[model samples]
Target: MEDVISLSVGEPDFHTPWHIREAGIESLEKGRTRYTPNRGFIQLRQEVSSFLSRHYGVEYEPESQVLITVGGSEAIDLCVRSLITPGDEVLIPEPSFVCYVPIAQMAGGVPVTIETGPENGFKLTAKELEAHITERTKLLIMPYPNNPTGAVMEREELLKIARVVEKHNLLVLSDEIYAALTYTQEGHICFSSLPGMMERTIVVNGFSKAHSMTGWRLGYAAGPREIISLMVKLHQFAIMSAPTTSQYAAIEALKNGDDDMAYMRGQYDMRRRLIVDGLNEIGLKCFEPKGAFYVFPSVKSTGLTSDEFCERLIYSKQVAVVPGSAFGPCGEGFVRISYCYSVKHITEALSRIRAFLEEL
Candidate 1:
C-alpha cells in the first residue's frame, strides 16, 4: 500500500499561491480575527461581485445579492434550506457530486434524480430536464464542469435547459465550484448568466477549487435579492459568520488569483489529456471531458462492474480510482480517475493500469 497511486480525490496538488496565503497571515498579524458580518466582509463581497461581472458578465449587488457561507457545501445547504419546502421535488442530474441529493433530503424536499448519459458527454440535456419536470418539481441542481464525469454544459445547451426551467418556473442551484478549471476552448460558461436564468438561479462558488484554498472554508452564494435575504437570515441564525481570516484572504483570491488559476488549469489540462488517452488505449472507452479535473472511463469492456473493477485495480496494481457508482446509479459502468496529480504521477498510474488490463 505504500506504493499505491491514489487518484480518487478531486483536489489540486498545488499549494495555495504565496500572495493569497500572505493575505490570510496578514489578517492574523493585524488582529482582524473578530467575526465580521454574517454575510461576510463587505469588501470581499464587493470583490466577488466585481470578479463575476468581469469574468462571466454576471453582475450581482454585493450588499443585497451575495451571502458568504463556509464553503460551497454550506452554500448548497443554505440555499436548499432557505428555498425548499417539505415534499418539494428537487431535480438532480445523476453522475454528479454526492451532496445535492442528501442535502435536499435533509431539507425535507424530495430528491429526483435525472440520469445523464455519456452519449451527450454526460451533460444534462434539455430533453432530460423537460422529461424530469412534473407538477411537484421545484428546483434543479445544475452541477456543471461536473464532478466524477468532468462534464461541462455548453452555452447552447444551457439555453436549451434554461428554456425548460423557465417553462416550469423551476429554481436552479448552479454549482460552479470548478468553473475556473474548464479546459474548453471557449472556457466555462456561467449558468446563471444565461438569459432569463439569473433571476431564477442561485450561483454557488468558492475559493477552494480555483484558488486551492480548500482548508480556508469559504464560499459565496449569489442570486435574486429576496432569496438571498432569506439565505442570509438562515446564515445569521445557524452559523453566524464565515471565518474572518478566510474572508479577508478570499478578497485577495478574487482580486489577484487569475494567473494562479491559469497555471493550475494548464497543468490539469495536460494531465486530463494524458489520462483520457491512456485509458482509451488500455481498452476503457473514455469520453473527452472539457472541464474539471476528472476522467471517467467506462469499465464495461473489462466485463467488470464499477465497484469490482476499482477493487481489483486497487488490490492488484496498488492504484486507486473511485468507482463511479459512488456518484449515482447511472455511473455504475464507469470509474472516475482524478488528474489532479503531477504528470509523472499520472504517467505511473497509467502504466500500472495498462499492465493490469493486459493481465486480465
Candidate 2:
C-alpha cells in the first residue's frame, strides 16, 4: 500500500544501452561537434535507409530519401506542413497520438477526425477512409501500431486503405515509430511497403521506441526524393541539424541494436499479457492491443467518465492513467494504461484499480 505506481506515460523503462552511449561519448571525444549536413549526418542517413529496407522491406536512397529530425514528433510536423495548404483536410483516426491534429491545424490544414472504436479493434477501415475523402482531402495521418489504443493495421488491412488512398490521390503521413512493438498474431506492416503506396507515403520512424533512446532525440523520415528534399529545406531552417551526439549514437543503434530491440519486445509482450488478463478479470473491458506499450480499457461500466475515473484513481489510489478523452473526443469512456513499468508495478497498479472499481 505504501508503493506508488504510475501507468500514465508511454516510454521505455530501460536505460539507453552502453554501446550506444559510448558511441555518443566517442563523438564528443573526437570533437565531432560541428554542424552536420542540414539533412543530417550522411552516415546516419545511410544506416536508417538500410535499417528500413532490411526490417520492413521498404527501400529508399540515403542521399535523397532521408532526413533525420529531432524526433518522430518533428518529422510529423514537417510532413504535414510541407503538404497541407490552407483549408485542406487531413484525415485522422482516433484515439490516436495527440500531436497530429494540432500540427495539422498549426500548418493551416483542417483536421477531420474519424472515430474508430473498440468494436472494430480500433482500426480505421477502408470504408471509413473512403467515406471521409473529398476534393479538399490532402493528407491522412496514419498512426498505426497506434499510441493510446495500441491498434495496428495488418498487411491486408493496409492494402484496403491503400486502395482508398490511391483512389483519392491523397498523401499519407505514416508514423511507424512503434512498428517494432507489435504483439498480435501477425507483425506490423508498413503502408509504404504496399505496391505503389511508397510514392505517396511519407514514413516517419525513430529509435526512441525501438532502441530505448527517447532522451537521445533522434528520428528520421523517408519518402520520394522530391518530398524528402522539401522536408530537408524546412528542417534546415527550423533545426540546423539533429543533435550531433545523438546522430553518432543512432549509427551504433542501427548497426548493433537489433538484439536489444528483440529483448525489449519480449519483455513488453509478457507485460502486455499480464496487464490485459488482469484488467479483464477485474471487470474492465480491455481491447487486446497488437502494438505499442499502452492498453486502452473502457471505464464506462464503472459509471464514471474517463476523466473522472482517472482523476479519482490518481488521487485515491496514487495511480496515474491518462483519460482517453485527452487524445480525442472518440476516446471518451476509456483510459490509457501504459505497460512501460516493471511487471511488479503493473501487478500492483491493477490491483489498486480493481479495488477502486469494486468500491464504485
Candidate 3:
C-alpha cells in the first residue's frame, strides 16, 4: 500500500528561513517573552509599515494605522467585528477562503456571496460588484490571488472594482496574505495603493505565505486611522497582543526574507505548471493560475460531484485533494490542488490521478 499524496494544505511546504528562526530564538534567549503592547511591538509595527510602503507604495503610520494580530485570520475577524452591525450586508466573493462568510455572520453581518467563474479567471469583476450591492451593504471582502482558484486581479481590473466601491461607498477588507506569491510580471498591487482607495480599504497581510512563517502566528492590518483604532481597541480587549517572539522574528522576515520568497515562489511556479498541464492532459480541464499555490481543476468530465471525486480519488488512489465544494457551492465541480509540495510529490500525485481517471 502506497502512502497518501496530500495536497490540501494551504501553507507553503518550506520551513521558516534560518535568519528569522534565529531571531525568534535570540528573542527568547534574551527573555523577550513579555507582552509588548496591545498593538504589538512598536518596532515590528514600524517594520510592517516600512515594508508595505517600500514594496507596494501603500503608506500607513506605524503608530496609528498598523495593528498586528495573531494571524491574518484574526485580522479578518477584527475587521468584520469592528465594522459590521446587525443587518449590515457584507459582500464576499465566492470560492474564497472559508473564514470570510462565517466571520461576517458571527459579527452580526449578513454575508452576500457573489459567484465568480473560470470564464473570468475566477476574478470578481466590477459588474459582479455592482450587482451585489444593496443600500445595506457595508463591507466587501476581497481575497485576491484567491484561495481555491488562485485568481489575481490586476491593476486595471481593480480600478474598475474600485470605481464600484466608490460609487457604493463600501469598505473593503482586502486579504493580501499571498501578495508576494503573485506570478504576473507586474506583481501584486496593493488595493489601498490605488488613488482614492486608501481611506476605504483595510489591507490584511502576514508573513505566513511569503516567509514560510505559518507557525509564527503573525499578521497586520493597515488602513485609515479611524478604522484601525477601533480594530486595535477590539484586539486589545479580546486578545491583548500578538506573540512577542513571533514579532521579533517577523521584523527579520520583513527586512531580509526577499531572496527566500523568490526561491519558494519559483518552486511553486514550477509545480503549478506541472500539475496544470498534467491535469489537462488527463482531461481534467485546469485553468492556468496566475497567483497563489493552488490549481483548481474542473473534474466535471468524470460526471461526479466535487466531493464524490475527492472521496473516490483518495480512497482508490491514496491521493488527497480538496473538493472545490468545500470552498463554496459554486465550487461544486472542481477540486483544488496545492503546488506547495515538491515536484516529485506533485508528479506522483498526477500519476495517481491519471490512473484514477482511467479507472473511472
State every prediction's TM-score relative to the real structure. 0.98, 0.98, 0.99
RMSD of 3: 0.9
Model 2 / residue 45 / CA error / Å: 0.8
Give per-residue lDDT, candidate 3, residue 311.
Answer: 93
lDDT of 3 by residue, 22-47 (tens): 99999999998898899988898899
Global local distance difference test of model 2: 0.93
RMSD of each: 0.9, 1.2, 0.9
- Ten residues in a row with the worst lDDT in model 1? 183-192
C-alpha lDDT of all candidate models, in order: 0.92, 0.93, 0.93
Q: Considering lDDT, where higher is better, how would the candidates rank from best to worst?
A: 3, 2, 1
Clashing pairs in 3: none
Residue ranges of candidate 3 with Cα displaced over 4 Å: none
Write out the backbone clash pairs for model 1.
none
Candidate 2 residue pairs in backbone clash:
none
lDDT of each residue in 1-360, candidate 2, tens digit only: 355688988889999999999999999999999998998989999999999989889989999999999999999999999998899999999999999889999999999999999999999999998998989999998999999999988888899999889988989999999999998667878779998899999999999999999988999999999999889888999898999999999999999999999999999999999999999999999989999999999999988999999889988998989999999999999999999889989989988998898888
